[model samples]
Target: EKSSHLSAALLGEDCEISPEQLYELLQYAALGKHHNAAQPSWCHIYHQSRLAGVVVIVLHEMSQLHFYKFYLQFKHLRKVFRHRFTLPPPSANFLASLCGEGSGLNPQGTAPGLISTGAECIPKSSGLQCDPIIRKYGKEKRGLTSYTLTSEELRKNDYPMRDSPGCKGYMYTECDLQRTDSSPLFGLDCEMCLTARGNEVVRVSLVDAEGQCLLNELVKPESVIVNYCTRYSGVTRKMLLPVKTRLPDIQTRLKKILPHDAVLVGHSLNADLQALQMIHPSVIDTSLLFARNEGRRFKLKFLAKAVLGKEIQCKQRLGHDPAEDARAALELAQFFIKKGPVKILQRALKDVPLSTFSIIQFSLDPEYVASHRLVGFCEKVRNKLTDMLTIYAGPFEEDFCLKSVKKEFGKCGPIQSLTVVTETYQPYVCIQYGVLEAAQLAVESLNGAEVAGSCVKVQRPITAATLDCDVLIKELELDIENEGVIYVAGIKKSLTETDLQEEFSPLKDLETLFLPKDLQSGKHSTCCFLKFQKSQSAADALEAINGWAVKGSTLRSRHALASGHLWRWIWQMNHSSEKQGGNSLSEKMAPLSDSITASHLGTSLNRDILHKKELSAAVSSIATPQQLVMVPAAGGSVVLLHDNTFIISQGEKTGSDVLSAAQDGTKHHIFYQKKKYTDSTASGGFLMLFKGK
Candidate 1:
């Protein structure tokens, strides 16, 4: 039951999130980053076949619920989200430049090319600028194969060109004399599923020269379907079951939609033409256009990324999107025409040496930055109470019996405690479950369940006690305030502060101890507190002398409560190290505590005067921060924010540094450096950009 989570269990074995891990879960979903204390979120959920590295999360923002699809990029996919940095909206265009599209990194912010009259200029060739490409890949043949590959080349490369006597069902594209090289270049890519006869076209995507998709359709094969080829073709049985369009229908549409001499462009387009059982002249194959040494052809995706700096056909996708592939090929061909081979080679060579300089930068608006800070702050607070297992449901009818409520909700899971509260105007019941899952299950399943013929709403309880439970429990743990302090009771009324210090000094490295005395009689109380130099020494004293007899009475020794005057004094001493003007804060704490203690003497005689002065002196002797304030951010994390700078620490044990500023009066920048240390947010360096004011 402890292993079960309502949302995670639905995702199958690829994900298993416990209640305590909910904070990190939301953080990963929101920020696309791994938690400092948890493994990368992709490690758990990326392997699911149904999800395909993409998870849909329901987010509530602007008073509306929105469904967002977050893709978890594999570790080796790219360095886009791997780095640690923050960006604001204004500097979004900077990302385009880093990806080699804009002029941000270019000299004088100019596009890379042969600049003439302050604008890029390219040599023209018959108004097409493709004369060099045509001269290299052979001229289009006039026989059955109207494309570039010759008879011998077609046989060697396994291209599907039906040029022999057995070609009966083939068709040819119509020709129009009005079409020329300047006609809109259309990029074509097809996906095939293995049919009993052979590989048949299942999906076809075509894009115009402007990268706008003109035709994207899924077709059912004429022959009996065999393998859907979901991995490469991205076609599943469920998808094609509803598709009624067939190959002949698609062929007729393409023949009419094409502008006769429209330059049909693709990568290894002969295969696509063969799959469609049609012949088209005036076609450009990027495979042959960007030819390699000894007829070696690179993949269309590889060529697109290398030449155009565009990433396509990533492994994270369920299968290739023919539209995206067609667009990539079109852009690749367009780039070769615009920049030519020589500039392309130079840019590729220049980019190789600068590949190590991978830092995503963007400018952010001030409001956007502040909003992110608030989000982080809220996440920290949510992380602290992830383990709470209580819920409240209420304002039920006054006559609603407790038995009826228990019988209704107890069906969900085991209940630890159920209390009926009727002190307020409306009555309600508080329920604490034995496990977090049970509590969650009760809230989700039994929220609107009827009890005593009346509907009841179940939800997490909101109360002062529940909200402060973690902080109150944290006081009992060994922290700076309660590290070396022990409480003792059953002391004789005659014992003074010096006498108790002398009695316990030999036991360990004694700092100072506190013994409250009555202000009216100035007599010591029956209990006193002890402070040691080390936590271990205090623990040892507590264990060794807890039951020891003191003045013929058994002494009750335990760790001191971290709240009350002692904790406040220790906290002040730690922060009072910094001196304002000429005096330290410790110098200012004595009179303040003394005046408060004197005014409260009538209410409680347990306010110590002599011992507090000694403890304050001992604490001042130790080194502490000059000024410090810790605010809890998302997931109960400590963050320091001042002006334009933000710093976040893992906890008291470790920290990471992030620096940001508006620089040069035009650009905003953020730089993060994660130290090579454990318990840090992450380990890496990033340079970011934001929009400036």
Candidate 2:
């Protein structure tokens, strides 16, 4: 019935055909006969000899038929015919013939109401059957088969009013192809913004499956005042300013360049497509493809890090570069293609064999479990067999030493391997047993036992086919015990030997002492040492002095009283007592002090000045060693004892005798208070360079 209505429409009917006539005509056509035994009472008055008038009358009769009843009958017949005939039903091919050379309706030309062909014409065949002549000469040859419907079919089928019949939700069908020769795999990256002007796109980049960049352009928005935080795009206002090219122009250029049926690859393609207002059917969303059942919230960078073992550092400033982003999206798509579809989280659980016999209790309350059992508990998690085991052991030990533990655990179970997680406060061990029973035994017996002196915990493991064992080994090698010793420089000048020694005395009791020697000649050097009694103490000391500062005046004043002055006065009084044959100076000078009035006191003061100046030039000019050597003192002010000692006086005036004695080493004697003292000044306990006589 549908075929008869289509045929009558093609014949340019003037009146509608009834349901009864249409059904009879279709039955007759299918049977390869024109005998209408049950024809409707709608015959036109026209002679067959006048074919044009007869054709017009037949068309007028067909046009008067009731199409609604005919449609219902056609649907019923389709089901009945399909059930009766074991052969495949005729498709759109039956209708194709009537419109083209394959149709047997065509007749020799010069006759009215018939199509005519010349020497170059292809012959027509029967409309109800596949015409051999037209099939050989008129079928579509080199190019893609046209899936487009004709105007008559469109009107009859109510096309263009509904969605395209061939389109699937997210997939492209052959009928949707706008280009035939190009590859279907491509990538897209877009930058969008909502500004004061309006919603607009800022940039778009395209890349092929091979990671070769194809198109990159900055699009100009319709208006300005670009908002910095343009949703998740990370495009800022500076990037949109003075926009490069008009958005519409860029879109037009892109449409011309891109294949209509290509698969679009991107991190979040839905967002990009929405931004660009592109309605593409074929798309590969990396985020969607890699999402775990844990949630639909997988980040692109995280997926890349886990799957590819490559870190992608996202730019924190400004707009994202279109070319780089597009390439990354393409790379992610390619990785998934090579690695196969990501396994669902629940499916990964199946890969991990559960131990039936060793049922361990897991608590959601970490604090309560930790306090009661003295053992840590992790939430029951679903991971690959290897990964779960690794995570289970991670709380007890480092991953590197897991092999040794695996060997020991294999005695109870057919252990394949093990992984220890060092991230937890307590060590965790994950064991992969060859059998589920062995895994059960291991988890039951070793869950709270100590392995290699550290508490051990057991669980299942996780595995990914693409996970690199060699990379894991490299990471394990870096987990060995590391001892770091940091050397710090740039100490303050005022820091004295005693100050440093006292500060680090606690450390010095633990390690050896090695002092730095000064290279230049000076009483003031910028370094000191606190030898630790132990190596660990050195580490502690280093931590303490990492940024310590010395505070106080560095230079001693010339006339100010100091501890050295009191010692010098006592030494003089002792020498004076020795000269008096054990008589105390307080008693000897007691009687003379009243009247004698010490006539040599003035001369003695002058002579002391001359001795000090002679010692200054020789002592201060001497060259010292390169390294500053700190000598440990018994108990006194931390003095920097140089090789040479030049006495430093606190008084403003210098005694003449002492000054002259300092200059002349030939006669090293000096007179003070009319007493003759031996020329023993050079013989005193002083740090000095000796000259061989």
Candidate 3:
């Protein structure tokens, strides 16, 4: 009892319990205090007075929590009674030796030498805990069950990742993802050869969680082979001569081979997905799982030898065998899951050549991963909120040509359309791109660049609207339904809808043609939008007639990206008209009875061209008693309203006069001068003038 190794403080007021009491204390804490029970809630766990199993309960602390232990025994087979119990001192003390000397938990323990008590629940600097500083910024709380790579990890690895559907030429692994550790694991590896389009998959290998080969196939690249890359890929022309599988065929096969809940495991897995042109919903990148210093990933071969205690990718072989590499990766993931991170890190330290354990230590912090995810999410949001997809570039010293603008902005990315609005005092061009990155690049690189000896300011339009204009435009452009439609800008103003339909309908696969009209002007702009029955037809049209000269002007064609904006504007205008108790343009045109005059016939030639027939039909439907005869003055026409207020209409313009002729109590009469219009062009109607008496 007086051993020098045992400290005198441990024999003080604090009473130590036996190992059985310690277990009973943890069981009591886990079961919690449930009041008003006929029998103990934990009684079910004890069968015939023997502990069969346990129910694990997770606990969270908002404040300091302490647990005490007591023994419960049945008395006389009728009721239970609590035995005497003791609570530890308020300060930390070795309550009992729960772990043996060879327990191996001391290295990760909060107190290296003492038994871990409730004090271990309190976070320590050296222990693993969820960081609280950035908890509110996360979209969803991190759960222990999730094994897929975080958003930050996916971006850091440059994986072909997608959060939504409708991205062209990419297929998703699952329509609805089940993010849990229970999903099946599939190891994947790919080898690539250089091609005209860059790295393309030459071989792919897949293995299940048990290291059984599921698929191994050789693929042919669509682009011409530029380099065999045999040094690393081990692919040569002779080996691939008989291979008929291509990327699409591989994609189809992989889709069929993989289950809906499978989780892909690989080292630098994004590279393989990119080479194969596929997007997986769930993944575990071994590079991130076993991190190195400063975001640098250890070579797959290095990890295989260090962690698995087995050598891989021997120098004697020509290149790595994908099936072997895939199995190695699969085992590494299984090891990490079974042994946990702390034990794995401790084991890796001995074999690690590096002087410090900082590499694997940093990956253990959940906050680091969460922060990276927050940054990536913020970046995506900023891109979505950006309005730079369309830019205004103009006020040129001289009229600029389409070719010049195309040459300048096309360097950034593919342009969807270029609209030249010359009707204003200072002419400007609206440049629309198929993606936001191109528009951002243009804004940064060419915002103040000189064009035609003048500095043109390139920026987003200053107008604000209720919807995200850029997102709608880009989404509509990439939609499969709009693939065959092309937006033709700089069309000759002289051409009509009938002219456009006749010109394009003769082409193969032509379906429908649409000519959009300005909402305010009620006349077609110098643009034509047409849809072909097939997407190939639209591509062919662009090649054949994009720059062909017609009616003294050249046509510029691009895949349509902003048709939704036009349709929305038209709907809003029609809706507003209906709200004001006026007939909508789509329902019935506004009557021109108040402004149909000689001055309008000559001055407003192209004005309201789309509504001329509708207006005529509306006027003809008016009752004869409601019709009024009036003389067309040289400047405008005058109309007397029912309230005795007068309005003057000049051409397509109209204004009301506030003069109160009704206060004079005078009568007005209209008289026609037939002789005055005898030599004039007003043949159907006589010239009539009104005078108040």
Best by lDDT: 3
- Residue ranges of candidate 3 with Cα displaced over 4 Å: 1-144, 163-167, 175-177, 353-693
Off by over 4 Å in 1: 1-163, 176-179, 349-693
> Which candidate's TM-score is highest?
3
On TM-score, the stronger of 1 and 3 is 3
Q: Write the per-residue lDDT of candidate 1 for residues 235-277, one digit (tens) a residue.
A: 9999988999999899998888887667777898888988988
The residue-level lDDT of candidate 2 at 36 comes to 22
Clashes of 1: 18
lDDT of 1 at 189: 93
Q: Give each prediction's root-mean-square deviation over alpha carbons.
A: 26.9, 40.0, 31.0
User: Which of the predicted structures, 2 or 3, would earn the higher TM-score when compared with the native?
Assistant: 3
Between 1 and 2, whose lDDT is larger?
A: 1
Error of 1 at 510 (Å): 81
Q: On a 0 to 1 TM-score scale, where does candidate 2 land against the true structure?
A: 0.25
* lDDT for each candidate structure: 0.50, 0.38, 0.52
- Model 2, residue 19: distance off in Å is 80
